[model samples]
Target: MYHVVIGVDDDVEHALACVQGVTNLPGDAAEKEVTLVHSFTDNPSGASATQIHSVREASEYLEDHGIDYDVNESSGDPAEVIIDFAEEEDADLIVTAGRKRSPAGKALFGSVTQSVILNTDRPVMVTGTARGSE
Candidate 1:
C-alpha cells in the first residue's frame, strides 16, 4: 500500500486543501493509505487527532472519496512530531499545507511546512491553501 502522511493543523480550509492534494496524487495503484497526522503544541484538554475540526473535515472528504485513512496525534513541536510520525509510518509521501504567509514573511523558520520539507528524506508535498474553492 502507498502510504501518505498529511500533517494538518486547526485550519479547516488548509486541511481540505491537503486532502485535495492527496486525491490528486497521480497513480492507479489499488491500495492507498492516508494518515492524517495532527500535532498540538500543547493540549490542556488532551485532544486527539479525530477531535480536531480540520482533521474531522478532512476525514469526511477522504471517506466520501472511498479512501482509507487513520488519525495520529502528538504533542510538542509540530514539525518534529509530524516528521517522527511520518518516519514511524514509513510514509511514501509527506504532505503539509501552506502557511499562508505574506511576501514579507521571514525567510527562516517558515513553520512546520518548511521544516518538514528540509528535514525529511522522503518526498514532501506542500499543498497550498484554498484560494477560491466554494
Candidate 2:
C-alpha cells in the first residue's frame, strides 16, 4: 500500500487540490492509504480535524472517488505538525497546496507548503494556485 499524507487547512479549494493530487496517484485508488491532517494554527476553542469543512469535503470526495482515508487533528505550528506527522507515518508522498509566492513574498510570509516541500525527503505533489495561472 502507498502511504500518503495530505495536509489541509480550512480552505475547501486547497483541500480539493490535495484530493486532486491523490487522484493523480498511479495504480488503483484502493492501493492508497490516505491520512488527512489539519493543524489548528490558532484554535482558541479547540476543534477536531473532522469538524473542519474542507476536511469533510475532501473526505466525501475521496469516498465518492473510491479512495479510503482517515483524518488527524493536531494543535501547534502548521508546518511542524505536518512534517512531524508525515515522518511518523513514513509517508511515501506528501500532498499539499500553496499560493504562488515570490522569493520576497515567501521570505516574508514563510509558506507552510514551501517548508513541507523543502524539508521532506518524500515526494510531494502540489495542486491549485492562487492565481490559477501560475
Candidate 3:
C-alpha cells in the first residue's frame, strides 16, 4: 500500500479531480492513504477566507470517497511545503495539478512541478494542462 500525498490549490474541483485520478488507478497499486495538502504563500493578504472554504470542500470530497486523509494548511512557499510534507509522511508518491504558464512566466519563474520533480526522491505525478493550454 502506497501513501499518496496530493498538493491542492484553492480550486476544489481541480483538487478533487486530481484525487480521483490517483485513487482510481487499477490493481494493487491503489493508494491506501491519501493526504491533501494546501499551502498559503507567506503574504498575509494571500491567506483569505476562500482558502479555508476550499480546504473544507476538499475534506468533504475525501469523505465522500470513503478515503481517509489529513488536511494540512501551512504558510510558506508552495513547492517547499509540498515536498516537506511528503517527506515527513514518508509518502510513496506525490500528486499535484500542473498550472499552465505563459512563455514569459515559464522563463521567469520556474515551474513548481519541475522543482518537485528534481528535488524529491519519491515519484511525483503532475496532472492538468498548463495554465493557458488545455
- All candidates' TM-scores? 0.88, 0.90, 0.78
Q: Candidate 2, TM-score vs. the true structure?
A: 0.90
Leading candidate by TM-score: 2
Q: Give the per-residue lDDT of model 3 (tens digit) for 19-115.
A: 6666565534334677888887655566653357656765676667666777777877778988999999899889887777898997899877777
Candidate lDDT (C-alpha), each = 0.85, 0.85, 0.73
TM-score-based ranking: 2, 1, 3
True-structure lDDT of candidate 2: 0.85
Query: Per-residue alpha-carbon lDDT of model 1 for 1-134, expressed as tens digits?
Result: 79999998999999999988888787632467899988888788887878899999999988887789989887878889889988988899999997767656746446788889889899998888764553
Residue pairs in candidate 1 whose N, alpha carbon or C atoms collide under 3 angstroms: none
Task: Output the lDDT of residue 37, model 2.
Answer: 93
lDDT of 1: 0.85
lDDT score for candidate 3 against the true structure: 0.73
Which ten contiguous residues of candidate 2 have the minimum total lDDT? 125-134
